[model samples]
Structures are given as C-alpha cells and as structure tokens.
Target: MTVPKGKLIIIGGAVDMGSNISAQENILQPNYIKFFEQGILKRIITESAHHEASKVEVITTASQIPELVSTEYISAFNHLGVNHINILDIRTREDASNPEYLQRIRKADVVMFSGGDQLRLSAIFGGTEFLQILKQRYQKDNFVIAGTSAGAAAAATHMIYRGSSNEALIKGHVQITAGLGFIDSVFVDTHFVQRGRIGRLLYAVASNPGILGIGLGEDAGLLITEGSMMEAIGSGLIILVDGRNMVETNIYDVEIGAPVSIENLKVHVMSIYDKYDLLQHKLLIKKVVKVENGVFIKADK
Candidate 1:
C-alpha cells in the first residue's frame, strides 16, 4: 500500500466562486478528482484540513482568509476523503507572535495558511511553533501544504510583503523580510506581475544571489514536493527567478525611485501542465505560456 504523501497547490486567479475548481483536485486521486471539484465538496475539503482533521489541520494567520477570498475552500474538504477541521484565528499582533498557540500547529496532516498580510503571517509564525509543526508534518508525513497570495508569500524562506517598483530598492528594504520556511531559499511574492513585484523579488535576490525568487500570479500556484520538483497547477502561471546567475547589481547605489541595473539573472515562466525542479532550479516541463509567468490579472471587483 503506497499511501499518498501529499502535494502543495498555489494558485493565482479563480480563487473565488469555483474559479479554481479545476486545480483543487490536485490533493485527491485522479479517480476522485471530480468529487473534489464540485463547489460544495471543496468547501468541506478546505475545512476538513484543520483541527477536526485527525490527520490534518488548517492554520489561518491572516484575518482576510475567509470564504470571500476562497469560497470553495471549506467545500473542497467536503469532497475530500480526509477528515479534519481546525481554524486558527491568530489575527491580532499579540496572537501572531504567541509561541504557545504556534505549538498547537503540529497536529495536522496538511498545514494550510490562508492569504492576507504576508508580513503579519511571517511575524506571527515565522520563527514560532507554527513553523516547526509544518516542517515536521511535511518532512515526516508528506502533508499536503498549500497557500495563496499572502499565504503563498509566507511559504518561502525569503518572503516579500510590500514594495513598489516606483520606489527605490533601498526605500522598500524593510518592507519585506523572511517568511515561514515551508520552502527554503526562495523569495516568494504574490499578486506578482499584476502588482509589479518583480522589483521586490529582484531586490531579495540581489540581497543574496543564492536564493531563487518565485512569483505566483493571482489565480495561479505551484505544487512543490520534497524531491526537488514542482508542478504548475491553476489558470495563471508561476515565475521562477534564479538569482544565482545575477552578476551585476547597483540596487543600493541606485537612487530611490530610479532605475536599477542588473544582469545575468535567469528567469523561467511556467503555466498549467508544467513542472519545475526546485532543487535543480530548472524547468522540467514545457512553458505553457512560453514560461513567462505572464503578468495578466483579473480584478476582484
């Protein structure tokens, strides 16, 4: 019996009202994918991956991670075979940084974080018990971990919260920082191209050229596993920025709001039906949209 370990699905648009029904089934077997796609079932699936889950637990570090941002979440659980549901509402500043609450994060087969303020999530659970629990679950049980927007932002070792391409690189330095270490050595940014976050991820890469920068468009996500591999799932695309190839950077010397010069940075854009080797830092699958991680975004309004 080769039990299924788990997979992480990070997506861009189609976050609301079944916009992402196609990819939600990534957590289930292909034979059972259809059941998980139904609107009602997905909601159950989302809620099940929590406290009630004898084998899973859902963690919400952000206040905005409600049904409004993800209507199908709770229902996703409805269709899923997994059984568990626990909502972690550590929204306040005090609660986010609380170590005790973070400790309870361990009892889960799937530790998921809802999207909101990447900074707030990081500040609350970055170095606390919440993070440790996730690491253990993922490494030991191959728990299915997932996040979007701010939630996705907090998955990487180096995380970007807020930054403006209009502003100078140094001006936005403190605006971003390290997020939860779900995926180490990668700087993650949400609302990516649509929000003009390339500069921010570039800045993170410039700070240290060893890390890879991953930008997830709204309604898009990347399913990453331990074998140094990741699958692209969702409507949008996933951008992989390899800072290791960076050669020149005048980020610090460049004036705020002025153009900065950088080169030798490698970039790969991936779309649906694609895969990336996180450990190899290369694209193992075809680039659906020419691997640009296209910059298109559908408004929430």
Candidate 2:
C-alpha cells in the first residue's frame, strides 16, 4: 500500500549548499525563460532564483532555531530564483501537522530539506498530509526534491538519523520519520564510509531484509527514480549494502553501540556517472566495477 515518496536526488552529507563556491556554479541554471524537460535540483534552483515562478521549500527543524533558519542556508533557494520559500520548522509549530503545509508541498517545484537533525525532519512529516502532497507532486513530475546531510539520509523509505559503527551491525531502533520516501526498499545514511555509518545502515537493512542500505559520503548522493534508475553523483562514493540474501546471528540482543555478528552482507560502491537499475536490483553494465577508496574501475579493460 505504501509506495516510494518521489524521485530523489541526494547530495552527500556536509555540502556547503550556501557557500559561494565556484564548483556549485555548474549546478545553477541561469536561463530557462521558456520550455523545459530536465529537472535537476540545481537547475531548478538556478531557474527559480532569477524568477518567481518556481517554488523552493525547505524543512529543517533539527538544530537550534538560528541554525535551522540560517540565512546563508536560505540563500540556496534564493540563488535558485525561488520567489517563495517556506521553512517548515515543524518541530516548533504544532500546526505542521495540519494540512496547511500540504498546500505548499503540492505547489513546490523544488522541495529541499536542509541539513540538521534527520530525526526532526522525520518526525515532522512521518505520516502527515505534507507527505501525501509530496507524493502527489512526485507522481506529476512537476518537481525536483533534494536534500543534504540529514535531509539526504531521510530521502529513502528507511532512514537512519544517528548511530555508531563499532562492529557487528546490531539492529538498532532507527528513527523512521516523514521523508518523501522517493526510494523504496532503500534506507539511507549520510557521511557513509567517512563517518563509519555503514554499520548503522547495515543494521537497518538486516532488520528489514527486503530493503537495501545506501550510505553516502560527503558531497555524494544517489539520484533515484520510482522508474527504477539510480545515478550516483557528487564528490564521494555511494555505498550499497544488499541484504536480500544475508545470513546472520541473533541481531535482537545487540546493545546500543554493541556490534552484531553479521554474515553475507554484500557491499557495492558507485560513482556519479554510474547508473543502477532498482527494478532489476543490479548495476547496469554502463559501468560496473570493483572499487577501492571512492574510485571505481574503468569499464574498459
């Protein structure tokens, strides 16, 4: 009964979406005065920044008020020509549970959730009207939804806000909040290998067995679609922990920060140029390779 939230574009954790870095310039599309088809988040932001037609929405309620409402962070939307930007600080507002936010959720062409508290973001829209509107907009292809860090982590059906990776992947209670659930059977963890979060994601995957775990490094993400396509993008690697056929010991007794003895937990990492077929549940030949660090093997021998 529950489907994916929408098409998703996740940027690896800790990206300075507010910085004036020149590299981010490439992500901006300054010109879109007319006809369009592509829906890259950056492209949409750039187009909206210069005009008022496109809507930019942000939901960051985890950190302190000042942090959640960082003007620098808000600039990410302003730069994209977003005439109207709403910060769904639902943590502070009980009204976020009301249907008013749904109206904004439906109108937004680019909905972005800022980085802060993944747990907060989840609690805000976990099972509310806002989530339904997000789903509706996704089905229409009239929007591009993206996130960074905490936001990125919650982009999948299953999400991990915080945890440690000391050893055995003990299944811990992950905060399953409201995210746009754009990636089905997929749980996401930001700052993957770099943060040693593979364990938490692995643990979450083990609990669901039917799902896949995605761990993204800083500035890296998996651009996914309900149509079953996944594109790895950004500066880091996207680690895939597949447990469809995993065999393991009793994960129930594992303690917080305790490790579980897991077996047959397969791992795969991909790059920005790579494409994966989710429906087929395998990497497309476009470029499959055994990888190390974050660099993958070249397709050509």
- Candidate 2 residue lDDT tens string, 1-301: 4334455677655554434431121223221211111223353354332345666777665544434345645665465455477666566436666566767776666777666667776776677667766767776654667777777777777677655567425445443444557666777777676657766777787777788777887667667666467877555678888888888756766666455667788888786557777677787434546655534454622
Give TM per candidate.
Answer: 0.72, 0.74
Say which candidate scores most in TM-score.
2
Candidate that would win on lDDT: 2
Report how far off residue 220 is in candidate 1 (Å): 1.2
> Which residue runs of candidate 1 sit more than 4 Å off their true CA positions?
1-8, 13-56, 65-72, 79-83, 92-105, 168-174, 255-258, 287-301
How much lDDT does candidate 2 score? Answer: 0.62
